[model samples]
Target: MVTWQNIDTVMLDMDGTLLDLHFDNHFWLEHVPLRFAEKNGLTLEQAKETLMKRYRKAEGTLDWYCVDYWTEQLGLDIEMLKQEVDHLIAVFPYVVDFLDAVRSKNKRIVLVTNAHGKALKIKMDRTRLGGHFDRLICSHDLGLPKEDLSFWGELQTIEPFSKQTTLFIDDSLPVLRSAHAYGIANLLAVIKPDSKAPAKDVGEFKAIQSFRQIIPA
Candidate 1:
């Protein structure tokens, strides 16, 4: 159980933590490939093979989350493509209640995400969860991805969180590790970021199946 008294800041991630990751997974893995195959006169398999190779090369970098980078690299209109399947964007179960619980406790709630500005705008508009956060920060503005240790210090400049009294939750182990290395006292992970996929093995960290499991007391 979390000791509510010690946690004054609740930092959260976007895609997999507050909202469903299935939309992003489908958009990148299936939707984008289908569009690429159709646009480039290649078979779907060929397109996927081509894109996946490029994606692997940029996986942990800021470029991996930049829509403009993907658009330029793939020669696709990523913003337009995201709209093509905006219907897939959705918030996870009990996320609103979880946010409300934080507000009720009067703790600072912030969203720190690596999602591109366009992508973040699209999801926030689609789900309308923007108002729940006290601050919404995108890594693009920081010039560093959360996987980098320096990102924590950069984030502190704007959000002013204390490592000892803040709780950071995310679906990515690398990001959690980044926070851990920065001396963040509380760290949590999500096991099933994409409801359609199997639970991930978040080694050496406490985890939850849903935000419901950690709703503020």
Candidate 2:
């Protein structure tokens, strides 16, 4: 059976890894652009197309997560808008038990996400996942997305863990590819993100439906 027998450090993604992704999906796919359109007196399609294009242009950069960047581009107070839907933040199924299992085995649990400080704080405040982590590392804090090789360098400089023994779990395929290029020993992909959807593509890591599937009994 798959297990992390000798792993010393476990890195987790906050959004879809430890928390439910429906909230983020709904916020980005439904709420934000609609509100932006309303505030700017634009049609929904016009606002979504424009903002999505801008975000697409910033896909691999830190600007993608910057609320200030969105505020300047979309002409809306992104923070306040986020607060409007903040109650949607939720922990994923069996995540707390998985985290508890890892900690019970004395593994170092680190939260490695590409979320912005303000956004991360909103989720943390609402979900309490912060209390479970040994360190909360964000791409915004590193000034680069985790998909950049330079980000791994910055992560090592700050956290100082051996790549051969570190384990990381995330939902983004691109970010997982970046981690593989950096030689992380173990990687996991949250495959069945929606229990209701059919199987699609698996990322650079081993795909699993549940976090508990990988934890040793």
The runs of at least 3 residues in candidate 1 whose Cα sits more than 4 Å from the true structure, single-residue gaps closed, are none
lDDT digits (tens) for residues 50-80 of candidate 1: 9999999999999999999999998999999
Q: Per-residue lDDT for 1-217 in model 2, tens only?
A: 2457768899998877787777877777678889988988889898888778877898878888788887787777888888999887778778888888889989999999888888899998888878888999988888889989889989999998888888888888888888888888788888856443455488446787887787656
Worst 10 residues of 1 by lDDT: 208-217
- For every model shown, what is its TM-score relative to the native structure? 0.98, 0.93
Top TM-score: which candidate number? 1
lDDT of each: 0.93, 0.82
Best by lDDT: 1
lDDT of 2: 0.82
Clash number for model 2? 0
Query: Which pairs of residues clash in candidate 2, taking residues 3 or more apart in a chain or in different chains?
Result: none
